[model samples]
Every structure is written in structure tokens, then in C-alpha cells.
Target: MRLQPRFRRPGGPWQASDAVLAIPLGLIVAILIADILTPPNLPLGPLLIVAPTMTAWFAGPLLTGAVGAIAVAAQVGAGVALGILDMAFLAQVLALVAVAVLVTGLCYLRTRHIQELAQVRTVSEVAQRAVLRPLPHRIGPLQVASAYLAAEENALIGGDLYAAVRTPSGTRLIIGDVMGKGLTAIGDAALLLGAFREAAHRRAELPELMAHLEQSVCVNLAQPAEGGEAGEGFITAAVLDVPDKSPKVQMVTCGHPPPLILHARQVAALPAARPAPPLGLCEMFSPEYFVDTFALQAGDLLLLYTDGVIEARNSHGAFYPLTERVARWPQISPPELVDRLCVDLLEHVGGRLTDDAAVIAIQRTQDAA
Candidate 1:
């Protein structure tokens, strides 16, 4: 959803945040009172420019212009009350007016720039959603929930990506992280997600689906980049196939972190016995990919995440303990589990992450068993 800036509405009434305008207004009043009480030689009239200058910080152009006008009028009143209409007094008034006008114009430019940035952010979000479509809350016998955090400020998606598709007999899921971050890595991420969604339904086996993804990434990396040089990029990923009739999940890892299974208040990582190289470098390793099977009983929750989650560090440089943290809330539903983890992950990193993170939680319902 598009989010409007909270500073001001297009045509609606003023918001409570605007109450901060009183600071500048109060400064103007205080200056006027002090000017009246002090001697003429003190020349306090020059300080009135501060009112409009301060207003520019919290208000838009129109409100800033109003404050400027008030300051100018007060300067003139102060000059008359002091009985000093000398050229110096007049110059001080003109100088105050000039500063106020300059600040007001600057405020207008800043506001316009913010609006343009908001437009760009909205378009970026729409494109990200199209490339990394949200997973369904319920897919056959499995309940699913996913969350993503971008290291780049104001970005909705980055190197991390996840997607799921339902097949004739099961649900296929893929969670991957590109080798880089920000806009530079979005192309590879989009390519991999597109390939996975297409192959997830057609390919009958997990290894075949992964092979297709590897080929796609290889083709993408082979292309010439912006400077007409061959691109060099890779993606770490884990692909899983969970059949509706079986109590096990088939997984193939491509140099990615292992997923965790939470059951009976215990958490265990499901690392592949022999993991394949990352997508673009698969040709460098053995041509065959190994598929690992793990039991995923009813009431069991599977947690898939990028390395950013486990690698997140605190002030003391200690890594986030993903397994221990998840084991504490093993009984929660898929959505609740994901929501709580996202919050906790951000808090652990001091509310800002240094790397892109993506997480997915899938739970098998009792009836499906």
C-alpha cells in the first residue's frame, strides 16, 4: 500500500504534529516582549529574523511565508516604538525580510524534493511486489507466512527473495539471497524467482527444479552488464518440495544456510549432507545435486531464512542465536511466529540491519497428516 507523508494533507485540516509551529510563534512573542522592555541601544530588533528561520524547519512554504510576514511586521513595530527610523534600523528590517524570503523559498524546494522521493519509493515498492509476490497464507495443508527487510533505507526489496507455488501433489518453496545488495542485485533476484515459479509447477522432482534455477542464473550472469562487461553474480538458495500426502520434505541446498524445524519445543537445523555450489557457480562443482529428506510431522514448523538472520550482530558483536530464539516459541502459528521473529530480529540489530534479510515460516496442519 502507498503511504502518504504525515507532515501535511493535500487539502485536509492541519494535523497535530503541526503543533510544533508554536515554538517559532512563541519565539516571536518573546522577542517582541523583550524588545519592548529593553533599551533602544540594545538593538534587539535584528533577532526577529530567527522566528521565520525556525519556522522553515517544521512548516511548509505557506506557513513559513506567514511567519516571515509576522516577523517583518514586528521588526517595523519595534523600530517605531524605539523612535529610531534611522537608515540602520531600515536596513535591519530589510535584512530580516530578505532572510525570511530566502528561508521560505528553501522550504518550498525541500518539500518538492520530498514529494518526488515519495513517488520514487512508491514505484519501487510496486515493482518489488510484482517481482517477489507474497505467499498465500494457506497453501493446501501448509500454513505459510513470510517477511523481508532491506538494508538499503527506503527500499522494499533487495538481494533476498522468497516465493512458493502449489503443484499437482505438493507445494514447492524457494528462499534465496543474491550475492549483492540494493538495486544492483534486484535483476538476478527477479530472474531466479521467475524461473522458480515457472519450473516449480512443471518439474516433477526437487533436483530438476533446482537445475532449472541454476541454468537460469548462469544464463543471467553470462550476459553483459552496464559497462559492457560480463556480469559476475551468484545466489545462495534452498528449495523444498513438501507433498500433501507425505510427512517428509525434500530439500536441495545451494550454498545457503540450513532451514530449522521446530517441533515439541525443540529446534533443529536441516543442513544438506552434500550441498551444491551457489547458482551461478554450479558448473564449477559436481553436475549432480543432492536432495535431502527430513521429517516434517503435523504441528511442526519449518523456518527458512537468509544468512542475514543468523549473522545479525549485537553491540557486543555476538551473532543472533536463531535456533535458541525460535525454540522458545515453537507452538505459535505460522503468522505469529514470523511476526514475532521479525520484530525480535530488528531489535537485536538496534533497529537497523546491515544486510538484507528474508524469512518464511511453513507449518503442517494436523489434518494433513
Candidate 2:
């Protein structure tokens, strides 16, 4: 169903209420002056329609109706002042009233539709918070920042997800993408985030944490497909562990995108040496996930993201070059870096994305304790 476009109230050096009062007053003054300046044969009564038609855009139904009524009253007074209250002049008055009534009805319907849309958007934002609470700006010694963009417009949550929290061993984080769309994908994302949050504190090693996540997925999703084969539901994930005292970060990839490391005006992809299967299908085809250790010195930045960022296409069907664009800024704060990336990504895809995207940035500060 195609919905009506939302009517935006007046702003930017103009107030809605002020315009409502000022427009009809200006119209009445102009009508009076035109009646006096022109000859009696010239009909200036029809110009009264301008007041209500313009006011309908910025006022509520009742206010619009009042403006329409004022316009009709002004036309009748003009006729009396000109000493011609005959059938032709009376007919003009009736026509002005009819047009005002129609415009008022249209304004009423437009206002009602806008209210309903606002309520729906509020509910969606609340659901997004229930699924994925906002990540903090700081986790332990690292400055953290995150951003998410859903595939559907007016939607707040989707298949892409990320979580970062201070754990017993260190600060552990995971960014994953579930294998579907809409509510089904959101459910899977919520389940994965819940499992990761619980297991991250107990398991210190990256492989062990991924193992726990795999077990959770296997137990939670076992329904058979239409052909009686096991259901194919899986999540591509990347898990990372950052210890407090060491300048090293350990990462494990499960068929997901490798993270990028930025240091000293250089950017490089940290691809997994031996990649394993995604979470849900690992039970059927067991593959050993390996922990790839890389040095993460102070002032270095680590960026974890979903495939949506790299898969966004332009008008020419060209995928976004994330690595090339991100290398330009190696010394900004984590929050500023994420903000810049979000703006640039939107520009690359012409201000819209076909898939859900997410990004998490963590910077190892220079004064780590």
C-alpha cells in the first residue's frame, strides 16, 4: 500500500502558528484594497480561495476551517461594500465557501495519517532498544563507537548486530550477520547477541567463545526444512579479544568479513589464516576455527563490520571501497571516525542501502593503564 507523504510543519525562520494567523489577515486586507482600487465590473471575490488552500498545508483541520470561514465572510463583506448583493455576487460567495470546505477535509485526512506514522516509528525504536541496547562509548581502556543502518526505511533493527562489553579476561566484542531478512533475521540476531553476551565472560579464548556460540545455535535451531533436510540457518561472525595489559588482539572468523586495522596512515585487512564454517552449519561440517593474533599497539584502530558495508552498490553497480575510504583518517577519535564513515557510506550508495549494515570501531588509546 502506498502511503501519503508526511506533511512537514513550517520551520526555519517561520513558525506554523504565526503563519496561520498572519496569512488570512493579509488576504482580507488585500481583498479589501483590490475591491476599492478596481472598478465594480471586475470580480475580485474569487481570489479569496488562495487563503484556505495555502493554510491547509501548515494548519490543523479546525484552524484550516476557520481560515476558510474568514475568507467567505470577507467576500460577503466585500459585496456589501460594493453595493452589489445580487444573484451573481451571491453565487460567488457560495462558491468560495464550497472550496474552503473541501480543502479543510483534505487537511484533516493528511493530519490523521501523519499522526499514525509517528506512533508506529516510536514503537519500532523501542523494539530496537529491546533487541540491542546502545553500546557504551568506552569499554575498559579502548574508546568504542558503533553505528547501524537497517535495510528497510523507517525500521530500527535488522539482521546485522554487534555487542561489546568488558569481560573477565578482557574486552570481548562480536559483529555478526544472520541469514535472512525482517523479523526472522531480527530473532536470530537477538539470539546470537544474547548467547555471545553470556559466553564472552566465561570463555576467554576466541575459539572457545565461538564454540560456545556454535553449540547455542545448534540447539536453538533444529527444525527440518520442507524437503525433510535439516534447516539451513547460520550466522557469519567475527570474534575479537583485547586484553588490558597486552598490546595484542586475538580474532577468530567464522565465514565472516575480516576486520581492518589502521595504524600510522596505513590500512590492512586482517584475514583469517584458516577460516571455519559459519555458526549454525558447523555441527554438520565440523571445521576447526583458528585464533589469529595481531599486534594492536597504542593509537591503532580496529574496525569490525558486516558485509552490508562492502556490498552497497552505486549507480554503476560498483561496490563501496570501504578500505580505501577509511585509510584517509587514521588519527581521529573512535566516535568521530564512525560518524564520518556512516556519512561517507551513505554518499557512496546514493543515500540508501539495500541491506542492513553495522560498524564498530575500537581505538587503543595512548594512555592505557
Among all candidates shown, the one with the greatest lDDT: 1
Checking candidate 1 for backbone clashes, the offending pairs are none
Per-residue alpha-carbon lDDT of model 1 for 180-264, expressed as tens digits? 8767699889999999988898898888888888888888888888899878878999999999999878999998999999988
Best by TM-score: 1
Structural similarity to truth (TM-score) of each candidate: 0.90, 0.85
Q: Write the per-residue lDDT of candidate 2 for residues 181-281, one digit (tens) a residue.
A: 88878888898899998888888577788888998888767756457766568999998889887887888899999999998889999999998888899
Error of 1 at 317 (Å): 3.4
Off by over 4 Å in 2: 1-17, 32-42, 86-91, 223-232, 282-284, 366-369
List where candidate 1 sits over 4 angstroms from the true fold.
1-6, 9-12, 80-83
Query: What is the C-alpha local distance difference test score of each model?
Result: 0.88, 0.85
